[model samples]
Target chain A: MLTLQFLPYSEIEPLSSNSRIRKILNLVRENKIVLMEGRLKPNEETDLIQRTMENLSKDFKGIELCTVYPNVKDKFLKGLLVNILIGDRTGLTVVGPANIVKEIKRDPNKILLLTENVRRKRKK
Target chain B: MIIRLRDFISNVFYKLFQQRKSLKLGIYGPPNAGKTTLANRICRDWIGEEMGSVSKIPHETRNVQQKEKIKIKHKRKELTFNLIDTPGIATKIDYEDFLKFRLPQKEAKKRAKEATKGVIEAIKWLDGMDAVLVVVDATLNPYSQVNLTIIGNLAARNIPVLVVANKIDIRKANIKKVESAFPQYEVVGISAEKGHNVEEFYESLFRLVK
Candidate 1:
């Protein structure tokens, strides 16, 4: 089963965010796929890579990352406000175990289509 | 819910720490392409220490070496990064190739094995790289199979890249060939060994990450 827990961009984007990322890393270690609500800011991205590199081992097979943006079919100011109000409306990121996510191509648009198509196939 | 409270708490913490940070810069190229020469020069200029030793052998740097916290200041802007100097990458590795270099059979095989492992490690390190400097020997034709392979891998990962046309101090060095070969990416010509045009190289590198 694919499971997800939402961690806001606000929580993980801070400079002194090691403990918060540690929390997320622990969840990943337990084989839970995490769906973060927004992109990891630049500094946070660096920290994530550093933390993830340190924790790599057989029991923990690292992670595969993918991101998707919901095409709301709008432009300009409306899009800007919607983005501010609903984080990751710009792009939602999904990180899962490397072994699992590798078989799934790392494309945001195709991820939804593939998941829904699989769900339909299983129901039938 | 706890999620709402957590968001409020994190927002408070976020304000405490935020600033520009360093990038992890990697240097990669084929064997005998002056990769280590460039690595040594960059370190000598910025960190005031050499990152690694350089030799004429095919695979002198058989392991990845790193020098942390290299800060470069040009004009009013400053760029800082953790520098990773990787081994020469090759498509094929045979122990026999080292024998031609006049090494004993036993030592040659050992070096070849280590060099192959180093190549794998360098490619794996790509995932962690924020940007890469592809050092090409300008005295030779830049249209080699190995150079193309390295560029293709960087393109696949979407990592920022800058090609360095090194060895320009040599009589045969031609920057135009290297530039024409990789027109898509910015190419800077410099004689890393002599430190000629090194300031221009530094400026181009800073611009690469910016």
Candidate 2:
């Protein structure tokens, strides 16, 4: 069963500055696809991507970030277009494909586990 | 009768093709800020008849009050504006206030939260509007949750806004303090009842829409 989620880009805040990669890693493990929609600062985008790479397991195929431009119409991209205030400025839409969506749903708790583990590491 | 028949047919065709254009304007402010009075005055003046019932009770407009297709002239051009009037955004409603409304304890608590949520939703709905008119009571202190939230959200979204300090006819009306509070935006003072500065209100609106 496919579940649809509307994740606001503003909700993506850096848990800590210890390791940018760990944060994205944690997010991907729990959710099928972390839909990154919103105007992200340069540093924020870098941190998100790094964290995603670190957290993704070998079984995880790959993560794809889809960018949907404003006022453009393509039938193929219609379902994925999510109107969101990106980076607190520009408005844009985003859509992710089935495989990436599936991965996030399969193991929702992985994100919490990864976050907790990373927090412990930071303390040490 | 041929001319009459042609006119009738054209009218039908025009009705079929005419798209309904509604300019959504949200009226928002704090409790006892005379938000309802302003809404009442606008509705009265637009239709030349009263539609929204006026009241002194705070939160009289508990949910969004919507009046559709109100016609206004701007720079010799006529336009339809839809007015949405909303409840005052007070800090979390205390249990006692909720109980005063005579709701069961549980329901009252739920309703209190719902009211706050409604205010937030109203602000969110303003995203696509052509303009927002933030109604502030001239007599009241300017520092308030609703005033700050509505103004800040509109500024953040870059939505065009007009701050109206209503009830200026009251002896207590302190329009200057309200004006100073929002230096970035020009504040217009008006008595929604006596129709004072009403023309100026429309003029400012004309400039905005143009």
Candidate 3:
């Protein structure tokens, strides 16, 4: 069975970058796709990729991550003022394990998440 | 002594110009995209040497390799820069994947650990580069997330980039696909291994530095 978990920005706001990455990685390892309310910082994303590479093993492959942010260029002044105040919390991030999530293709219009089917054997 | 003073001032300006010519050009792309091959080709063409070793296995280049003071001359136009060939960036790196290449368990794990470090180092070196050669495997899909992320980061920094669609000798190589993927940037197709259309690539380098 496939699972999709939603994590709000507030839930991770208080945590450090490492802690937030760990929390999301744990969910991805369990084969659950995490839909985060806000995107990670740029350095945080690099750290997450490095951490994922370090944790790759037999059962766990890694993660497929992508973020969709609104084009605030159209409203540059308002966007800049709002960013100055609230720290640019305006995007959705998706993280899924590579084993289960075959691919996550995102264009300007929409996202196409493809997954592979795995059959479990019944216990004897 | 006015003539002597003028010569000294001219020498100072010449040194400064030489310093400005030493731009850093980084080669970045996904795994097995022929980055090392291209770096070696560039080095051999100019400096009569090779930069790094190449292998069919992914992550063979698990560290950043650099060749400095490479000068290329084309049609009386010359450009000098430091060439940095970085490890291929990837979202996933499983040690078991290395075992498929017949590597021992211990060796594979060590390679994976070094590869993770290499990826971080490559990203960290981005700030120091003056120009970049974003290498893409012409036979593969050009719209991958890794490619997009690397290009996006460079664009955000307003860095000068020249996309190299490598391996045009292969049957499945499609330069048009890569061109369509990055329409905004200039894409040059070349068989880095076989040395096809490399003269055109060298000419493009002059435009990139400018």
TM-score of each candidate? 0.58, 0.53, 0.81
Error of 2 at B51 (Å): 4.6
Report the number of the highest-DockQ candidate: 3
- Could you give me the TM-score of model 2 versus the true structure? 0.53
Q: What is candidate 1's lDDT per residue for B87-139, written digit by digit as tens?
A: 88764455666888898999987886777667767777878988999999998
What DockQ score does model 1 reach against the true complex? 0.02
Q: What digit string (tens of lDDT, one per residue) describes model 3 on residues B31-140? A: 99999999999999899999999999999999999888898889988788989999999998778779999999999999988887888888889889999999999998
Off by over 4 Å in 2: A1-124, B1-21, B49-51, B74-77, B98-114
- Best candidate (score: lDDT): 3
Number of the top candidate by TM-score? 3
List model 1's recovered fraction of native interface contacts, to 2 decimals: 0.00
Candidates in descending TM-score order:
3, 1, 2
lDDT of each: 0.73, 0.58, 0.88
List, in order, the clash count of every candidate structure: 0, 13, 0
lDDT winner between candidates 1 and 3? 3
**Which residue pairs overlap in candidate 3's backbone?**
none
lDDT of 3 by residue, A1-124 (tens): 8899999988998889999999999999999999998778766777788788778777787888887788676899998897677655787889999888878887643678988666532231
Ranking by DockQ: 3, 2, 1
Cα deviation at B137, candidate 2, in Å, is: 1.4
